[model samples]
Target: MAETLTAASSHGEHAHGEMSFWSKYVFSTDHKVVGLQYMFTGIFMGLIGGFMAYAFRMQLAFPGVEVPGYGLVSPVDYNALVTNHGTIMIFWVAMPVLVAAFGNYLIPLMVGADDMVFPRLNRLSYQVFLLSAIVLICSFFVEGGGFGGAWTAYPPLSAQSQYNLTPLGSSLWLVAVGLEFVAFLIGGINFITTAMNSRAPGMKAYDIPMIVWMIVVASIMFMASVGPLLAGAVMLFMDQNIGTAFFDPDRGGDPILWQHLFWFFGHPEVYVVLLPATGLVADIITVFSRKKLFAYRTVLYTVFATGVLSFTVWAHHQFVAGIDPRMAHVFTVTTLLISIPIAEMMFVYIATLYGGSITLTTPMLWALAFIAEFLIGGVTGVFLGASGADIYFHDTYFVLAHFHYTFFPIAIIGFYAGISFWFPKMFGKMMNETLGKIHFWGTVIPFNLIFIPLFVLGASGQHRRIYDFSHFPNLSAPWQQDLRILATSALLVMLAFQSVFLVNFVWSLWKGRKAGKNPWKSNTLEWTAESPPPHGNWSELPTVYRGPYEYGVPGRDSDYWPQNEPN
Candidate 1:
């Protein structure tokens, strides 16, 4: 039984239109508006990223054959697309959309802050994010058509500065990433400050919503771990601009040093992006399952464990980079050891489902899909974690299939679930459930049709990052044109299916059925307020007595439970 604190709540900043259009639109500090800005930008970037993925997948599946309605993507353009794809997916879509967007929008409400601790700093963080986006886009029109080096931007290649970075394009890529990291660092600092110091009168550490906890820990990870990469990017820029020998092997600099520095932040960057989504799914599943999270404290511990483990596993990306055998071995142990936290959380998830009467709503459906599909990603992760095994799968399409399974589920499924879970709360309207289901099945079936076989071809040793995969130099494995047909056809179907979601998403705000404050009847401060909560969020500051996952109490009137409903 959770006790909710109800203090007199007030909506501040009732002032009406005190500023000009540019001021409010471009420089305003309101988190909700800022979040919406991030949401639209992230979605736009998703379209760009998805199309790049589709364009590349087409080339891989069918060499020398251009699809109708699309021109041939040149190797340089393909390189740009790949770089942009990785960059957009990581920085623009996953981090901004998942963490920055939701963190800004929901964290304050859940923790009972009227607004961020430093609202102007919050707005400036977003402006920096926008600047980063611009720099990245500008790189495309440069003489060499953007940085040809992979998103990893490894040196010797990136450092040659003559072959690829000769023009200012590669220089711009470094600048863009530098700014983006700064954006998050600022936002991360703001998030931690707001959560720790600005909570409602009585909300304690354990009393805050799981989403808040996820973001807080993720922020901490971002702060502690991001410096190496930030410093590395600076060193990289110097290699191109001033000839600092950080990664220039020709100048007695070690290229592997870049990988070490990059993945150092790069690995934890995964959790920085995914942990918020994981927290969102945890709340959504428990609410829909009509039970408390199986082990609340363990879930928090698991989040911390995963964050710690992430820093140690960075070298898993370097097994094939000629890293020392002893270092690789140490990394392998760290990588495998990270799995225990995930496995522990997994046990908690399935355990929650054991005696629950699940409501298969759109959010819950995505959560189920997340668990089942992520198992593939997670297990394959273990396979990659093993250094001896990874030497074979390292550069192959196997890596492709594995991360797509990982990233897509978190990005698509997590955001989609957040969409489903928060739609009512977001727009005060419920999207058509029928259409959501159609979109779900549309993506689920075709998603598998495309990626599963990629694993086969990958295991048979199909190298990644090539435009003409037929030249992969592995002819012993049966190369079939069928892969082309299946993958292309599946991709098209997936695109079309997502259209239903997009359409439903847009159309529902005005046309979908109206929703009540707590439609799903979940146990969280969020449900204690109105659907599309007012600017102030709560009628009163909500105090918590139990954990966020309390649901389906036997004596409850219906199959659901509300977080703050009186015992």
Candidate 2:
């Protein structure tokens, strides 16, 4: 430990040659190391979340079917799976992998900084996140098991402690969620401060890569949007632990207040996740397509426009939640309006690919699929955004399909795009392209198979969160059971494919082909550094002379023009 600290105390990037194993990998302050830690942990949590989904999907497909060890999953058990699945996937898996991991790895490297301005705080951010995950995992073992209240944890249900299935679990769940928020809050502050204050010499605002800019904006949006929910979490916690009636309607507290608070943050949280992905896709597609990103400044403006507009559309989620009827029209307009900027981003992606020397690399496949799939997610949302249509669709499998379409592509696929595109940069070795493409096909096909049937089930009036569809005549109609079985089977297939990715990821780090500094031949600042950059990122940070997406300029000797290449 003493030797580790001694090495860390050394100044400058090159002076860390004596770094002990602990100083170099565990408890390390290096941004790249920290990012990989977030990645691995997040992926682990994702598997847990997937298992939860599998449990509930099994129940849905074959009600009362007994397992080898555990007996038939009770309705209560099904509800718990539903609740924890949503909570863990969104909070633990998606946020950590999509935002925290890459954000930490790329912001400094791409922005031409040595590391985050607040490196220790960055370390602390991940620590708190881990602690939160532990607390959540602990909830599952508490008296009565984890809270059965849905991830939304809408109150009266969540507020009643004595009668609730997992009173202790609910309280712990709140604490876990609140801690996760705090962790990200710390990271968000570091992200914004670093981007605003720590740019290398000669790098101006416009010179900053779109990925960094989008992440910073997303961080700010998160910080701003989360305040109401943070306050709401506190109030709900008090209601659950103390004798407060903040969300208990029987005690003069409005249950609806919780919905408002949750969705206000919840809706903007979607954009908070998506914007970074939008920026990543922008960068990845440009690199693979061999073209300068079309309308780069325009895309940046669209990102800002998307963030600013996100706050206004939060009530779209509350359309059928008994809010004032007149407000629906207002929210509907805002919700529909938000799509214009999103559509602009998609159009620009297509334009960039139009006249380019496109290479359908694994990452490029993910990027292109992200655009195509996310568009479906976006278009379907318009139906739910309309107050009238949502009246029927609320809480149906349709909403489930809609969000999975949006989130699956953006969070799951988008993260893979970035991970695959930058695998060499992150670990200094190539991920096997053949396995990557195989994994891609394995994922994309089964993903569609699972969700498309879900839309059918929803359109047929199958409400979500019900434990036994056989009990309901409308839901248990002849083909409905078959549909459930099919979706569940597809889900298992999807889970099976993820194993391929897991093996490829673990095997490639040591055994894959050596990836030199710039395997992709892309023009980004991070690529200018060594693959898996050393302790301080650069012995001396490179100065940026141009924007990140300067490809295919006429008369250039090579197809790419790097940002640090002097004109």
lDDT of each: 0.81, 0.88
Give the per-residue lDDT of model 1 (tens digit) for 143-211: 887787888988877876665643577899899999999999999999999999887654567777788
Show model 2 residue runs off by greater than 4 Å.
1-17, 68-71
Off by more than 4 A, model 1: 1-26, 67-69, 472-481, 556-567
In the predicted model 1, the residue pairs found to clash are 5-543, 523-563
Q: Alpha-carbon error at 489 in model 2, in Å?
A: 0.8
Q: Of the candidates shown, which would achieve the greatest lDDT relative to the real structure?
A: 2
TM-score of 1: 0.94
lDDT of 1 at 373: 83
